[model samples]
Target: MPSLPEELKDLESKLQHTLRKLESIQKALDESTIVVITDQTGKITYVNEAFCRISQYSREELIGNTHRIVNSGYHSREFFKHMWKTIGTGKIWRGEIKNKAKDGSYYWVQSTIVPFLDERGKPYQYVSIRTDITRLKQYEEQIKYMANHDDLTGLPNRRFLREQFSKLLKETKEEERLLAVYFIDLARFKNINDSLGHSVGDEVLKQMAARFRTVLDQKLFLTRVGGDEFVAVAPRVNYQSILAYVRTIQQMLARPLEIEGREFILSANIGISVFPFDGEDLDTLLSHADMALYHAKEEGKFYQFYHRTINQRLIRETILESHLHRAIERDEFILYYQPQYDLFTGELIRLEALIRWYNSELGWIRPDQFIPLAEKIGLMPKLDEWVLSTACRHRKMWKQRGGVEADLSINLSASHFQIPGMAKRLLSIIESNGDDPCRWEFEVTEHIMMQDSAVVYENISQLKEAGVKLAIDDFGVGYSSLGYIKKLKVDRLKIDRSFIKNLPQSADDQAIVAAVITMARQLAIDIIAEGIENETQIQLLKEMGCKGGQGYFWSPPISETEIELLLHGAE
Candidate 1:
């Protein structure tokens, strides 16, 4: 054994070494974590550099204060009370805390509070170690918000709407109030989106969301369900009140919205379903409202309510759409020609080609019934192609069978002119079939001229330049714009059958017909009075200076062979 003095020196050396290790540990903790020490009364006694830096406070400022100096008030009093109770009983407490800095900025921390106990196992002072988790909490909150809100418009998303729907339904039931679910669809929004780029489309949607917000009252909530569609929920409303709200929505949306320095006149078809009357559940109510919206769009109306008849109509339409997809390949469509004659001489002037469909399953569908359906399902282009091709084939046959030098009038869909190179495509179809453009007159409605598309104007101009005859079909019934008439420089204005059906018998019809004829003559355009069924009507049209017409009085729309016989006799 060594001497007692030497042993004392060794013990002192070991104590110094241990003190150095403890100081190194304290420095590491100060650098890596926010460390603060307080007395048994919760008054701060010391704070490390990390604590002062994270709290945006000087050590001198925090030394005498409690943790309440940085309290954010984000937690309930009970939360802090429970935390203090745990540490005050000589126990360590672990949890997350939200705290505010001296600059009023908020932060999050993962905190562990430890109590230093006295010999009696009672708390003396507390030490808190915290790790900053502000960034992690922000990421979590961002994800949550993204899940519940629309990124483009900052409105509640469809998922959030569905989540809140049940709660609202419960409240509505308890309060004995009605709820109206409005399915609003923007009309012709596709045209805007397709013609312009998506950036403009997105801006349009954002502006619409802002406008919709202006109309929202305390009882109403609006949600963007998807592209060009929004749902408005109105609670505590009766039928009349719901209608009033709909009118408000209509009027608010009707105001012209200027986007990207261009003005757009917007309209929406609103479909409404009242609670406990139309449906009790969200899905059912939304479905019914959608059905109403479909009917409103079909009927050219602003708003409609749910009814059972719409369900049946929707079913038939769904079946028809499915069948129309296979119509061309199945060769279920045919063209019938109706002859136009000179009213004074009873001579054949031209043949108007009308389409007729005989589906294998749905037999003998009228043109009026299937034509609009075809247009709705985006099959108009294909149907128009078929019509042009078949009409050319018939004209070729007529020429081979010693035909007269009369034009073949074919009604064209307004959609045809929407294509960029529509004139070239159409003329290619006719020329490929060995037909002359001069022998064909493409008849278009007055609404076709109202499209305001550069493509439409370009196509019409191209057709006119290529020697194809253009005529305005159903003239008086549509929006009669004198500008469109003069701009198009059409070859003929076919007097709408409505004015001619009454003829000399009805003075209003005669006055309308006579006015149309006079205007056509002044414009150097020919006029054809259609739906003529008697000698008196023919004489009246001749007296009005109308050149030609076609109706049941001369011949109904006849078959290819029947019109071919008429063609031979006309020669």
Candidate 2:
């Protein structure tokens, strides 16, 4: 118990200091890393407290067991083979590893395994260190999902569609089977958007997409390529089966959708194209499907299959669409004036302006041929502006020629009607051309008005306030209720030619025409009969007290020069 020598005392103090340093190092390692030591054969020998906590196993349970006990099965045999090759050669192996816990939960880690070497420089034991990266991996997976899926409908997006289509097409070709690519368009969805508003329209689309996904079965892949447009691919399908599937898809789309307590029915135009038959490539297949969809809508059918004929029509339409913008710049559009007369007096009261395109290369493209194409390509607004400005100028010139005083009626397409500031734009065009707003009338069909939007009403109100007359064209051909017509506050109603052509012979037509005239008179709205070809139809119209009329009988659509001679003041 006596005091020791100074040298021995100093050695004892240094030993105690070294032992404390080792203890601190061990504590630090226990707190930070998930450490495990295994024999070369992968049997666990030691595990730190952190490792046990992560794997939900006690140290005693982990030791003496194989590392395979915690295998998540997420990695392939090849992955493990590469890992083993690295560590077995006494080299440090680093990788991201996913492991399963005792309670069947998963975790991710960035791991490093260091192999301990024997005298022969071969591995005898391995020491592993891991940093828990489960949260980071989860975030990465979520980001990937967002990138591949549409935010609105939660369906696969265009990017994902292309990826899957590429993979699926390869698989189909290898399996020697045909694949069907279907392009679906929600018909008249714009009417819903414009009338009910975008919010309701979104809900309707969601409902449609949900129904489509629900009934599609596991074999088909559905994607939302864009607004109101969905693309789907069905593998291992043939002509008969593909046609049956299309019929089912269309019926599903046609199902009623309830929005804001009202039942709404939706219709879709579906276009189908087959792999290797339509085209072997993705772009070609999509293009052919789109063409078939256009043809389906053209034929007023729910679905159409791509054929060589559709390809030809699509090429022609494409050429026309590509040139429409230039057509306006080149002054290829002309206006024809169809004169309306007093039924009894044959007095020219008004002239309806019709647009006819004279493409320099194509030579006189029909309005029906190019207008819908123009509308699709966003050229209708400009084309409409050009037509209106030209018609106004023609009317001004007619006035200069022989004092023509009849109102000039120009048709405003639905595409132009949807423009935000259409009324003000029209007013500017009218005043610029030295045309009287009161003497110039705008014709909008009932189908356009049936949309019943606040914007439409506002535009109409603004036009009328500026002394422009508005008429409901093709009166009975649309689905508008009488309430909408009353709300329009238009100056006149033009009886659709359908009712007039068979008048005085067909009882139903006679009754409808008579009722329309009587209603117009009661409402103080002037009625004009359209498409009067013979004298008997004119007589019947005159007797019905229809004050104004226009048709082939008076004169077919005439040029601006011919209009001057037809003016009452000229003669």
Candidate 3:
């Protein structure tokens, strides 16, 4: 055992070490934590400087007050009850809490409560320790906001849209009301995006969202799901009124928007599905709306409402698209030649090769029925190649039979014409089939203007340089193409059949026919009037200086055998 002086020295060192540790801990608590001590009855007895600083309270004012002085009312009574119960049992409790400042501002805290017990294990005092986490909570809320909103447009995103839709759907069902889910996509948005930069596109979307907000009011909910698509949900409305309101909204949307001095006319294709009629659930409603939107795009209509038949239409289209893949392999296609006659000389000028499909399952399908579908399904290139090869072979066959030879005019689908190296491919097909380039011609509709103009000009120039003739079919139908016709250098312009169906009996038709002929002459482009069914219409076309004509008056599109017979008759 050590002497008395040694024991006293050791006790002094231990006491000094404990005092230094307590000082360090007190400093740490003051810097980072808000410390407060209260009696077991919950009256505040003391508060550290950190608590007074954070709560905007003086130590004197907080000393006798309970935590209710800074109550935010954010927590329920049960929360405080449970917290009190734990502390009363000589246990610890921890949780995140919101508190009010003396200035009525809100602050967040990570809080813990400790019970100090007496010799009997009964709580005598309660110590509450809290860390100010207001800034951290703010950051967390900001992250949550970004996750639910579109960054570019600052609109509620798909996730938030679905959540709000769920709540609205429940209420709508209880009210026996209807809800419309509108799926909208811009029509020429892709072309605009490709032509202009994405910045301009973003500006357009922002302005569009602002415009939508004006028309939406409080009843309609709008969200920019993504890209050039948006969704609007309107609840507690009937069908007809909803449709009318939607139309007004569309009219507002269609108004031209000017960005950086450039004007853009945006058109939207809208699809609407009503709850309790189209679907009882969100997924089913959205799918039906998407199908309706697809139908609107396909039919060139601005909007469509979901109906039972819409699904059937999609089914038939899908089946048609599938059949088109195997069409060439199964030899389901045939070419019918429509004769173009010289209006003045009454002589056969040429026959336009038109494709007709006779599906084994669904009899003969019209070109109007399957041609656009084929293009949409990405079968145009293959379909056009087959037509070119078949037409070239048929022309060679007709010539070999000692038949009168004229150019077999073939109509080119817009998709095939706009493809790069189209001229080279056609020349190769012509050479392979042993057909003369000068005796064959290609025709395109006015839709070619939508393609890259420079590319089109180059392709057409190359084709013309190789002795291949070109024509613009369905003239005067497309309003924008007529002014730019000189760029194409087409050899012939075919008057659309709509103008001729009314014929000389319709004064508008007569004037249009006369004007088209004059325009054709001025541009050195030969004009052909189609859909002629009577001699009166023929006389009117001739008088208008229309150079060539073709329709039922001469002959409907016929087989090679009939054309061969006609060739013999001509000889």
Q: List clash counts for every candidate, in order.
A: 0, 0, 0
Best first by TM-score, ranked: 3, 2, 1
- Residues 406-425, candidate 1, lDDT per residue (tens digit)? 68889988887888998998
Residues 319-423 of candidate 3: C-alpha lDDT, one tens digit per residue? 888888899999999998999999899999989989999999988888887999988777887888788899888777878998887778888887676678988
Task: List ranges where model 1 is wrong by over 4 Å.
Answer: 1-106, 112-128, 191-200, 260-262, 276-281, 398-406, 502-512, 533-540, 568-571
The order by descending lDDT is: 1, 3, 2
Best by lDDT: 1
For each candidate in turn, give its C-alpha RMSD to the true structure in angstroms: 4.4, 3.5, 3.0
232-347 in candidate 2: lDDT tens per residue?
89987777878878778867867789989988888889999999889988899999999999899998899898999988888898788888868877778888889888887877
Select the stronger candidate by lDDT from 1 and 3: 1
What are the TM-scores, per candidate, against the unseen true structure? 0.82, 0.87, 0.90
Candidate 3: which stretches are off by over 4 Å? 1-17, 36-46, 60-91, 100-107, 115-126, 134-136
Write out the backbone clash pairs for model 2: none
Once fitted onto the true fold, the runs of candidate 2 whose alpha carbons sit more than 4 angstroms away are 1-19, 188-208, 254-264, 294-300, 377-405, 415-436, 465-467, 502-511, 539-548, 568-570
The total number of steric clashes, by the backbone 3 Å criterion, in model 2 comes to 0
Scored by lDDT, model 2 comes in at 0.86
What is candidate 2's TM-score against the reference? Answer: 0.87
